[model samples]
Target chain A: MTVGLTHFLILGTILFSLGLYTVFAKRSAIAILMGIELMLNAVNVNLIAFNRYVAPESHIGQIFSVFVIVVAAAEVAVGLALVISIYRDRISTNVDDLDWLKW
Target chain B: MNFSLLSSEMLAAGLGTGLLILGLIAPKTENRRGFGYITAFGLLAVLVATFFQYGINQSTFHELWIVDDYSVFMKQVFIVAAILVVLSAVDFVETLPRFRGEFFALIVYALLGMMVMASANDLITIYVGLELMTITFFVLVAYQLGDGRSSEAGIKYLILGSVSSAVLLYGMSILYGLTGTTTIPEMLTKLTWSPILVVAIVMLIGGFGFKISLVPFHMWSPDIYEGAPTPITAFLAVASKAAGFAVMVRVFLLGLPLEGAVDWMLLISLLAGITMVIGNVVAIPQTNIKRMLAYSSVAQAGYMIAGLMSMDAPGVKGILFYSMIYVVANVGAFTVATLVRRALDTDTIADYAGLGQRQPLLASTLTICLLSLAGIPPLSGFVGKFYIFQAVMDKGILWPAFVGFVMSMISVYYYLNVALYMWRDDPKDDRPVPVPGPAKLVIVLSLVVTVVLGVYPGPLGELATMAAKSLF
Candidate 1:
């Protein structure tokens, strides 16, 4: 049996679910950022697989995935900066500690 | 491609870059207030440039960028928001420890992103523009380095906003896979009903829902609003939400159509109803003024979403009209709040006692703004609500409209509670609230627009109708 589009989509969905679970479960801000990166990577997988199989005539999906990769990198950079800033003040990156503005 | 078509965006980008260079070259002792004035005037130029392009309907970059009345109208809304924010933020920016130039420049960059969203004709363009705006806000939200709350708000926004963008991208990938295209107009013809399509639509809603701060996805807004600088909070409430609505309309109404695909209207209406009820109900008990406005803006988003039930020109028109007035009313309210925060250095509602006696201008402006938000008769907010509900009623959707009507009534209580504190209670301190010149101009300008638009919404109403027609 040959590998197919459905298989790739399943892998992508699994990665996405894992990432989302990480985001919800993780307490550390850095871990949450990692989870976001994983989710973005899952999207990249989906985009590439779709481009390879469905729209091979044009490279829009591949191009979109490239844009996603770049943006994900930028987002991570900003996230790390924020995490470092918060860590300097509170000495912790736990999201639960961010209750200064809560109702 | 006709470069002239992108004149406004180019101008905004140039202005942002110019400000950064100006900051570097200017003498260390020089005041940064000049940057604010330059940014405001530059945006005013961009706003005028959009007016010249208003009636044009064209697309470029292989139909990936569009120029039409719809985009022009939305661009004007964003530019007006940026201008008001910059004007009011001049004094606030001067108080920042450092990076004052970056504050104004980042706002312009965000405005540029919103303009791009207004004209984006492809999913990729939309995603890029959205990220540009969000990333800048991530920095802006955290700009107050000495304040832990500001930094906390920034990180939280970054994490949640990135996740939402990822979810939105996943949905876009599915859409491209199903349709084999990324262009919205191309996808329009290729779309067919499937279970996966429903998943994609839901993901899209969830993503945009977060951007507009719709209920359930709005968890980050109050924290962010309360922590960020007041002018930036106002900018988020007015310009960012409007940009989300603009793209949502383009994607759902124009691209997906949803005629034979799914009954997404039921889903949207359900969300809209809950958003109104929960937003207003939760807002009633908030002691902090910014947090209350954050929840109130969420409820306002629900009212705008109700207009989407009609899926027609009239509904779109109502949204545009309401967004315009929302910019005016919300900025007015936040400007007063900004002054109050600066004076008392506190955001608690009780701190505002007897503001009517101390500084009648600030108190009266805040009252009018809150009244407008509460939808009192003869105010622009009331007229805006009427248009939205009437559009939904015309569509024969009664429950969401009725829920909106009742929730807005519930909203009046909290809004008036703040008003009563200002007017009825004794002063905490006898010293007056200082009204800076630019902020005073913003207040009076917003007040006039709020009142005049309520009295005669004819011209703007017609313009909104025209913009709505162009979308179809």
Candidate 2:
């Protein structure tokens, strides 16, 4: 059976749902970073899907998806660095403790 | 849509790579000021290249990046603003303990993103450029993460900014679903007001709203501005924010068939009203100069939003013109704030007491900045305000114009509080030191241009008109 747009979207939907779950359920900031990564990858799936279905003839979405991957890697590096340092300072990676400013 | 890549992107990219390499190769003790000088030269060459590119009537690359009068106009503004920011940061950045080449490199990266954003005609390209900017900013804010405030600022920005991006991405998906295209002109021909696309508009506004620090979505701004280095704050307030505005204008005008335009205009008008009211009123009670200025930036953004919503020749032109004025006035304010922070070791308004007596040059220049920011006559701020109001009046938005006028009046109290502390002879401390020549030069140059622009805005006004016409 040929994988159509809905099939790709269903896969992306699963990835996005998993990402949302990671964001809400994870205590570690790095875990949340992973979740964001998942979300972006899901976006990539949708982009390539659209490139396949809508344009079918052009690779605009695929090209953009590649750029997105590079950006996502950069984002993860910076975010992890921040999380590591925050963990060092506060000695906890739980996202809940970040509420020192919640007056 | 491929012409030669904008020289701004090339210069900024070259500078970033050079900084990364130099950061690895250079000795720790060598004069790091050379990095600043090199970056300044890169931006200057880009500035020259932008004017040269302007000779072409229209240029497009890959159907996603377009260069016409509009983007070229903003390219010049962003480059000039960035050049002045880097020049003024020489001593400020040098003082940081762990100053590496990455600081300047990230700045150039952010500027490249800003230029790309200004020129982007594709939703995907705009998203990439915006992310590039926000991520660089996430680092630039916490460059001094050893400090608790800096770390806190970074965290705040990250959480809020991430959510905004997600919403924006979702909005992009909706737009794609609706129009089946990410290209701006294609979407313009295909835009329809389904329930989903309307929701997408809201999401898009929320995303851009965070960057611009407009009301109801501006919570992270004051903390981040205060925590970041002053030069980055200037960049955030001026360039990155303008870059967001650039995309907002393109999407609403050039990227849509103007359907649902009225509703969006009304919504933006309401946002402008609240932004002005909240920004001015909240600033009155803030003791921290940076925070006050941050709120004031929110108010100034409201004026620009009003200009964009007006959607006429003058309305669009006014937004561009006022943005130019804001770059000068805001950088001037931040410059004085940096000087005073050096002198008094605090940003508290009380620290400014008897500044006129202690250091007349610094105090007077700061007064000029404050007055201009308050929209008093014969300063660039006044001209900026007048142009925005003229646009609103031209659009016949009487209620919004009234709100804007009233907010401007309320704004004067806080701004004058700054001046009252400056020029008042209540010597709360001992004497002051002489201003450094470079810092003084920034002040004098900004002040002189402020006066010149306010008195004769015709030339710049014409440029704004021409720039706005390029949108169509």
Candidate 2's chain A scores what TM-score?
0.93
DockQ of 1: 0.88
Tens digits of per-residue lDDT, candidate 1, B339-377, equal: 999989999999999999999988988989998988988
Candidate 2 chain B lDDT trough over 10 residues, lowest sum: B256-265
What lDDT score is found at residue B131 in candidate 2?
89
The interface RMSD values of the models, given in order, are 0.7, 2.3
Candidate 2 lDDT, B1-472, residue by residue in tens: 4437565577678878888898889998885777877777877887887877664545466577778788888877788788878877766776677865577788888888888898898988898889888988888887775665666667667656776776677677667766667898888788766765677788788988988989999888887888777778888889988888888888877775555532577678889889989988989889888899999999988888988767766777888888888888788878888877776678788888888888777777777877887888888788887877887787676776788788888888998898898787487768575566556767777777778898898899898888888776
- Evaluate every candidate with DockQ and list the scores: 0.88, 0.36
lDDT of each: 0.92, 0.79
Q: Which 10 consecutive positions of candidate 1 chain B have the poorest summed lDDT?
A: B257-266
First chain TM-score, candidate 1: 0.97
- TM-score of each model, in listed order: 0.99, 0.93
